[model samples]
Target: MFDFTPNPTFGPLQNPDLKVPTAAMDAQPETIIVGAVIDAISEQRLPAGAKLGEQALSVLFNCNRANVRRALAALEAKHVVELRPNRGAFVAAPSADEAREIFQARRAIERTIARQAVKRIDADGIARLKASIAAENLARSRRDKPAELRSSQNFHMLLAELAGNRVLQRFLAELTMRSTLILGMYAREGHSCAHCDDHTGIVDALIARDEALVLDLTDRHLRRLEAELDFERPVAVTVSLKDQIFGS
Candidate 1:
């Protein structure tokens, strides 16, 4: 149900007639395209299970099919997209069961990170977290929901990094993206103001080196977020075929 019309100010070229010279190719095209795609997905500008038509992407990004494939492959590796054989690629649609499993997994991983972070958190780590929180507060104040939501999510990833476990950190990063997508698909508005406060509590506990309290706070935080979603409705499959066929 997301709109795909090109924004006149910064829209991707819609079916440009000129070919991009391979010799003068921009290696950063994939990165740029992927970032935009990710932002769209995060904001629910692209809905769950929506088809990411390769031809459309090629035209949108003004890149060739080859680069579009590469970018999509990367997104797939991150579990952000599912590549079906003859059906082509679509934004990943996580099942209800998968959503529960992801939240449970996040609880375990985030709690562990919180406990570990308390033991090792330094001045720099605290500073970074404070900056993240400040940014979240600013976003909330300005009613920038996307920025607030992304910042709130990034705070957890920052905690994982503070824990200094590269393996766990990488896993959390990927899971975080998938979790955001799931929330966008299912979560209701005015779910909880606790998201911001939970983050503040965790930071306080970390600063105080209260490992046990940090673990408890993180567990509760994850549970509170899970409770916000209206999962009773069946997974939404509301993409428009016309929009897919003709550039919107």
Candidate 2:
């Protein structure tokens, strides 16, 4: 289950609703734990390389260490969390090469998605894209990084959905989650990775049903975002695991 809340300063932020009923948590503790960790990672609250201790997580999620271990194993299988021998689990940190590869994969996949989206997007689809852009703009104006990043990801995922390709949508979902970690580590400070104008232009071309133009814009926008990352200067921001997951 998920819940979204509107922020007074920006627009609505779609953070995971962590307040699960005890019954549900007891039934699916691993699912709840995995979701909370992913949400935190996507939002940059759980920075790359942040330690996810079993004891702390078990306490925070009101579960046992076994459930936390299973959840960590699930996250590791998804490639979003890394488990080390005797060291426990930490958020996955992509190297410079891995980061470039992820973006390259995104460009290839998203261009195809944009082409299909142009062919299939209707009035409702365009409205959704525009709404996402508006929310992104509000987040940028307020410097709400997490919300802005979430909005950007949602826009791309929406395009994938409109493309009507389940396989590509699933692939893009994984790539986007991986990109969040890359961005958290390498994106330059004070830079908007997904510029609002670029998204608007893509939407414009989609409205015109210009497949070639959409493809060009999508490629260029992704390249620009990739260029904004400083591979040589990885930023190491740490957050208290419990605090970031729950609250300060």
Candidate 3:
């Protein structure tokens, strides 16, 4: 059964009958709440299929139920959360096929970005990529999985930004978030290559303005990541309801 316990911040109003606060009625709430929810999911602090209790969220953010509803509606539009008839909002749980499709789409998008980025890449952009690579190396040395993962992900995002296509960048951001969630659900521990040299190869190709080489390296990198995924079974796990509500 799905757990729907309220967080401690909303403890006082655990009762559905309790009235929501009126203070948040006058201001904007959608952006803040949506960001919080997304951050929670991305960090794996909130597990897949966990219920997003509107009342608890309202209290946690010090907003009214109306604003909380608006935030959830926004998440629904992003496909980050789904609304069930009797179950309310829950984090999206992607199937194995869907996960494979997301990676395929990501590879296409990123490969295109890498090709274009080679022509438009500047010294500053190259420096940023170098910094990201350095950060990833540091994280690997320290054995910090989260940091290593984020740094590797940011490298692709930096490439997209360098391509100077805002629309592609936006879409890539959403796709990357979904990919991260899929990885969290299906990845094996210690499976990621934290000290990946593939990124450096892409950067080198970009510096040489070799679009073909850049695309080839990007495609190979993504394929390597996909090969690491354990798809034989779903690895989804239930997180503590208390930790979900009141994060450390």
Q: What is candidate 3's lDDT per residue for 16-90, written digit by digit as tens?
A: 222222224334677777766665555455556677788777766788989899889899999898887776888
> On a 0 to 100 scale, what is the lDDT of residue 11 in model 2?
15
Best by lDDT: 2
lDDT for each residue of candidate 2 in 1-248, tens digit (9 for 90 to 100): 32323222111112335435212555688988887777677767767877787876776667899999999999999898889999878789889999999999999999889888988999999999999999989998898987888898889999999999999998998899889889878888776554669999999999999899999999999899888899877455344545447753
lDDT of 1 by residue, 1-248 (tens): 75656433123233232124222445577775676666666545566777787777876777898888888988888788899888878889888888899988988888788878988999999899999999999998998876787788779889999999999997887677778888877888666655898888888888898888989989988898889888886655435565546634
TM-score of 1: 0.82
In model 2, which range of ten residues has the least summed lDDT? Answer: 4-13
Candidate 1 lDDT for residue 13: 30
Estimate every model's Cα lDDT from 0 to 1.
Answer: 0.76, 0.81, 0.76
What ranges in model 1 sit over 4 Å off? 1-28, 241-248
Pairs that collide in candidate 1 are: none
Return whichever of 1 and 2 wins on TM-score: 2
Cα RMSD for candidates in order: 6.3, 7.2, 7.0
TM-score of 2: 0.84
Q: Is candidate 1 or candidate 2 better by lDDT?
A: 2
The positional error of residue 204 in candidate 2, measured at the CA in angstroms, is 0.4
* Candidate 1 Cα deviation (angstroms), residue 80: 0.8
